[model samples]
Target: MFRILFFLIIVVSAVEIALFVWLGNVFNVWFVLFGIILTGLLGALLAKQQGLGTMNRARLELSRGRAPAEKILDGLAILIGSVLLFTPGFVTDTIGFLLLIPQTRKPVKLYIKKVLLEKIRNGSIKVFRHY
Candidate 1:
């Protein structure tokens, strides 16, 4: 997993740099910089709003004595979206925005949940308790 993640990071960084250079040449360095900043700011705000909404739903569920499992998944997606949005890359920001949007977030959350459950069943993931 670490190796896969490291490879992904390297690939993403290279792609981001390539995009930056291409855009800078087509427009201007300042324009590219502005785009990066704008995306980060807007993405952060969207993620935050979605996250708060998810949290509220979770609280409402709890008040009704129900488990907020789906809301928790939404929160996880929002958290990941927030991180990706702040990562400074067009691809990441686009993906981050998708995750932040409830319409798109459901698929992403389902994928994550599926993977996690598979890992748990296969013993690739484990839970530990502290005393």
Candidate 2:
């Protein structure tokens, strides 16, 4: 798994470098800079909106005496979106947007839950505190 992950990282880096070169030649450095800035602004706006919505939903769930599972999922999505948004690339931006959008988060949340459950079942998941 580590080997596969390393290889994927290398491949993604190479692809991003190639894209950067291509875009720089086709358009300009300023265009790339503008794109990065635009994505950053858009991501910030979306994060704020999603965060408030999640908080509201969590409050409502608590009022109804239900667990805030949806809020947890929303929080995870927000974190992933933020990380992706910070990464430089249109691909990451697209992924970030998908994670930020509530409609797109359901399937991703389900997939993450399935993976986590499998890890727990296989005893690959562990808990540790550094405090």
Candidate 3:
């Protein structure tokens, strides 16, 4: 896992640098820089707004005496999306925005739930009760 993560980091960095250089040459350095900054700022703002909504839903679920399982998963996705948006890369920013969109998140959330359920069924996920 560590090896794969490290490799991915290296690849992402290389791709980002290559893209920066290409964009810089095509549209000037300042334009490229401004675009990167604008995307990051926009994505951050969107993530923040969505995060607040997700929290409210979670709180409402808890108030209704039910576990906010879906909200928790949404929160996790939002967190990851926020982090991706914060990262200085076009690919990450695109993925981050997708996760930030409620409409797009529905399918992703369903996939996450399905995978988690499968893990539980296979005994790959361990659950512990704390008293």
Task: Provide the lDDT at 81 for model 3.
Answer: 89
lDDT of 2 by residue, 1-131 (tens): 99998998788778877887889899999998899889988998998888888989999999999989869888988988988888888777888999999889889999988998899889899856787
Please rank every candidate by TM-score, starting with the best: 3, 1, 2
Task: Kindly report which residue stretches of model 3 are placed more than 4 angstroms away from their true locations once superposed.
Answer: 128-131
Q: Which candidate is the best by TM-score?
A: 3
Query: Compared with the true structure, what per-residue lDDT tens digits does model 3 show for residues 1-131?
Result: 99999999999889989998998899899988898899998987898899999999999999999999989988988998899989988888888888888888889999999999899899999878899
Identify the candidate with maximal lDDT.
Answer: 1
Worst lDDT run of 10 residues, candidate 3, spans 89-98
Residue ranges of candidate 1 with Cα displaced over 4 Å: 123-131
> What's the TM for model 3?
0.92
What are the models' TM-scores?
Answer: 0.89, 0.80, 0.92
Q: Which residues of candidate 2, in runs, are more than 4 Å off?
A: 1-9, 120-131
Residue 92 CA error for candidate 2 (Å)? Answer: 1.6
TM-score of 1: 0.89
Q: Model 1's lDDT to the true fold?
A: 0.92
